[model samples]
Target: MIDYLFRPQLLAVVFVVVLGLLYHRRQPKPSLPDLPWLNTKEGEWFTTLRARFRSTVNYKQSIHQAYDLYSKKNQSCIIGKLNGDEIVLPVSSINWIINQPESVLSADEPHKDVLQTDYTFVHPVVVDKPLHHETIRSELTRQLGALTMDIMDELGSAFDDIWGTNTTEWREICPFETLKLIIARTSNRVFVGLPLCRNKALLEHGIGFATAVPIASSLLKLFPDFLRPLAAVLIARPNRYHTKCFSRLVRPEIERRQKLLEGQNGDLEKKLGDPEPNDFLQWSIRRAQESPYPAERDPDIIAERLLAVNFAAIHTSTFSITNVIFDLVASNPSKKYLEQIREEASSIIAADNGVWTKSGLAKMYKTDSTLRESSRLGSFLGAGLMRQVVAPDGVTAPNGTFCPYGSCVAVPTSGVHNDPEHYPDAATYNPFRFSVERESSTAESPETENDKSNANITEEYIRKANLSFVSTSPTYHPFGHGRHACPGRFFAANELKLLLAYIVLNYEFEPLTERPESKWIGTSLVPPLTATVKVRRRKQNM
Candidate 1:
């Protein structure tokens, strides 16, 4: 009875309506773009209320409906959201939108609003000063090559510890839970290094913090402007606890690094026996030392930044790999896809003398395609490239659609991903779609005489460039698009590929009867949380 009553879909609607009613009288009208609303009688209070209520439950449905009606015609449209309204631009406007200056269309602003960063993150400096992003975009990315072996080591240990070593019998394990554990430990190997990365309390609280932010944000959005501060305190209590837990775990490490930096005299090699740590904590401390604001160098703030990065890395990587695993198991009942992926990975690893290098991972085209296809089919968010209009006068699309200041604008990421025009048979999970195109593009023979012509060479080059999992564009943006796209995507792609490659080569999965259906709460697709996989270890380890 509790399960039936608290199902995500039902609970979302009930929660939205009840809270919305309480704040309805005091809430101000949302400033919107000059576009068609997915709802009817847009100005009528009761009608708008009903539409907003429907949207929480039918957000994906409305996305598709708007796509067919407006996006197909190359026009933008507005859709109701539980928090507010958003203007979803068509594929035609993506380039123009992303090219706009940050002052006009702010990328980070929307995230700050959605995550309720001021409250949930516990320090204004964490969001106000985004050096963490710089750490990821520069230091973390630069060190990925060096960190690969460490991640590989952690991945193996995590798998053995959580999945166990019984090779003879098939074991059933929950994919989501196990993958979350594997991702947290594996990612933290780069974030904080060993011992601390393996701490059970630290990991649990980190996961709790990741889970709490969204819940706290949702609850905070339910209150009127005047009551939000009080509401946020009550709603974000869990996040506060989690933050304290992270601070307790990481404070000692931060202090040790501070001392090392302070006494180094700009020459760390002079330390007789202490080797410089090659991890994110050390990198962040170095980065923060250069900041003009003193708070940016505070130990607690640094710990919060680590928590923020952990939240980003663990949550998204877990979702991505879990979807890939499920898609591989159930998308095709036949063994063909798995066999091909295994062959590609094994051949590449063998060619590299059994070392997993960045260049080596690049050559596993089939493995890359399988993950990309799953991303398209099972996207985590309905929209991408969401931004807030920050200029006082607002901004206008190239097509002359006007989005006023305070309006949230986004592109329908999943809509484009699912469009039949962009992807052939868009609904079916065809894992080899990109690889087949790749093989043909470089093949001696052509599918047709036209394919051999010089006219199509540019098209083939573009297609080849976009085939990698980290690449993003207007039509395919699971990692987002343009200059402001997710900075950690490159590291994430490498980690995911190594994990997938290892799984295919070392274990065998019992073919699932059907792909487990995912649940959609609001615009996010929650992968089958409790879905189980039957697996047996191969006699030889890859």
Candidate 2:
């Protein structure tokens, strides 16, 4: 045994193990806030490690426990996480958290850490310069009016091809799996354009990349910083492969656009009688060219940006719509409520001359409310507005809790959405809650009728604005809240609303006897992937 232990390979393995231990020990630990820990006692290193692993599985329960025990009482508490421990602040601190400067409380750091974007995105430049967010926030939003018809066109074709045109019988379909493809295809129609969006290989790779990133990110976080790069080379292989596939696919388009830009002397819009393409690819190319970072301009990185946007859009919309389907069906066991939504959708579409438009989709208030209600009840994350302390000394909450550098702070999003103080009968699913609120606002209220003051105007504006699915507040933040709210929410709202409207108008769905319970995978409240619904094409014409 002594001789075997002296062997060179064995000695080398031991040496590496020692080095790893040392590296992990030297890693900076967050000076977490003075808050009571939920479900775990803070003690020695082993206890903390044990809590972290336990929390990974019990996160859903732990969050609710924290919410009830402390958050509801206006207190903060610490909860263990796979990535690290997080300070779960009360809903009252939401305004305070969002008001802080980015230097002190950074919204981007948590995202970068959680997604492990440095590796998963295929390059650091992708995370460092998130021009895609800006493009989505500005150009895509501005183009929504124009893209509405294109999105609708894709949804119709997607449903026909995937869901079928059979009016004779009801077919069982897995919503999660089917919606993923439909969303990927429909989103890509506006992302790349007609032919490429329909490319079987491209869509597969895009979906593969989206699926791989989260899995890779989760695995990468389990490793120490020193081992992550080496681990990522193996773990993030799928991400790299998909990024390469994306680069190969988009290189031709990038070259073609680059030549066009060069021919027009760096301004495609400036050229006479030539209208620039209106797609995400075009938008990203233009945005990338404006950057000084070489990686940002590289065709490979540009392609990765397209996939990054895909990663953000696909799973989120798919999950949301999946939940909406289950909620819409289960809530109306007799299928009566669906007809009300369908009538709203049909009437709105007919009023818009048989074409879906931004304004027309917006008028489907009941449809919007259904989605909003679903979001409130079935949030993907237990918490929201997550921020990492970046200031050297750390920042203090309005209630005087100190969170040092590296500590993450977030408000209980799911908890707030279900809080009785915020949402009455919070346990029940009320699909038309927001629409009712909107309708009530349009009529004369005591506040609006008796008061013509500026404060009352602001109050009325907020009251009306808060009802929309895209709008976010402390109480309703599936898309997050404050200035850092989801940039793609406007586009997501349009696409989802149109998709829901199309389904309601064109198909007849059999309501579920009971809602399928959603599962919690760490922090994500995942809708059942295998959940199926029966549907048949309606005989009536649109």
Candidate 3:
């Protein structure tokens, strides 16, 4: 009988049966391990497949529904399905998951996967390491106080140019397109600075590249990861368009900086020729010189780095501005939210000799909170702090949720942001939620008078709990958390606050429709592609 069981046909049948079972098992449950899967209307396997299919199809509703179901248990570990793969989503284990060393849960790989950033789509010159993030985290952020005037100047010019000065009447316009121009120009002013930012064609390419990176990534991801490398040969085409364009834009600047640096190689503290141009391109060159790469001042390399910064800065800032725009005028006119913000911006700028300051932006807590709350309502991605278990041993969560090696894990950003436990009346848009948090935080943790006077406004705002637009905490994962969190958030905070302050103080907006809902594709939440907000110029100037 044992020999009979080992017959060729019998063994083949068993192999087929086992393969089917394993495939079905990988479909995952819509609930935790110990619990029977919920959403049983379509049967176990069908529910999983349907949800995964809907993930790419009608995404936002599907993920939110699935997450809501799984989160009801408030379990440390819950199983979810995405694109036919079982995922380990931790609700209560956010800190442990996000803070995991890169060895255990690799964040970079997820970005590569999401961005489809292989030689196929991006050139070899495209960054393998996150040098741009380093530049943003350290150099650019430290200079925000100094760059405030530049951003304000850019903000004023970009808004005036994009929103138009002649529209004294309530003219309707799409928020995304309008804000994209405003954000691109405002961001590039600080990014490349001066004449480069003023180039209309260059700014347009920045927008194009920013938009193309994700679209290309999404298209490439349509192919499996293993195939992506091979696919890049045929499907990807290794587009170096942005690299070529931006390289020309900044090559002269980088060459001048290199010459200046060569002359003043003795010490970094020493003033170099032209005061060492304070912009992203210059910073990239300085960092590259510090690194081991031979192509330290290579214009193409510098442009790739610049493109990365533009992509990050323009994409996030535009949507954030749009979201806040919708939220600002969404409420009843009597709530007087817009009026209050106008009053605040006018009062703050009046005191600052009519100039935007890093410190002055800090006092715009209502504006800051509106940005934060808008972000909290609709985070950039549905799942943030994504990681994949890379270690062979695999790691266990703080709450004892274990993920096997090679498993994908992430915090449900949408779920966390909307949790009623964290935000009361979670469904509603409460711009002042974080503002109140700021005030209550101020009262609970009073600083010494000397401490208050000595601390910079940026430091003071961050020191308080719940006030900062860029505050990174376990509860708030919009910018993510820990070391892997968005390194550019400080600059992002300043950019957003200043832009919104300028808008609220200078314009009046009325929504043409209900609060505009963002577009959801897979895990990403894009601000509605088109939201027509009626706008009129405010006659007052700070």
Candidate 1 clashing pairs, residues 3+ apart or interchain: none
Model 1 poorest 10 in a row by lDDT: 1-10
| lDDT for each residue of candidate 3 in 1-542, tens digit (9 for 90 to 100) | 11332346543433444445555556543332343332334535677556455555655654565467664455443334444343536566776676678888898877766776665235444556767777887889889899998888888888777787754577778888988888888888887888889898788777777776665565455444444554344333324565466667777877776766775562434754336567777788888888887764567777777778888888888888888888777777777888888888888888999877877777787888888888998788777777877887777666556667766677667777888987789998778887865655543232445665543535445556545788777678888788877888888888888888888877877653477777776667878876688888878655
TM-score, model 3 to reference: 0.85
- Provide the global lDDT of candidate 3 against the true structure: 0.70
Candidate that would win on lDDT: 2
Which lDDT values do the candidates have, in the order given? Answer: 0.82, 0.84, 0.70
lDDT of 2 by residue, 1-542 (tens): 11332356544443444557677978788867657876665665677667777777887777887788887778889888767889988878999988899999999999999999888877877777788999998899989989998898898889999999999999999999999999999999999988788888899899988998888888677777887776666667788888888779878988888777875557777763578889999988888877776567778877888888899999999999999999888885554778898889888878988878877776677988988989888899987899999999888887778888889998777777888888889998888888976756653223334565545456665677678899988778999889999999999999999898889889988878899999998887999889899999999958
Winner on TM-score (1 vs 3): 1
Which stretches in model 3 have alpha-carbon errors above 4 Å? 1-48, 72-86, 120-126, 233-239, 266-274, 440-463, 511-513
TM-score of every candidate: 0.91, 0.91, 0.85
Q: What is the model-wide C-alpha lDDT for candidate 2? A: 0.84
Sequence-dependent TM-score of model 1: 0.91
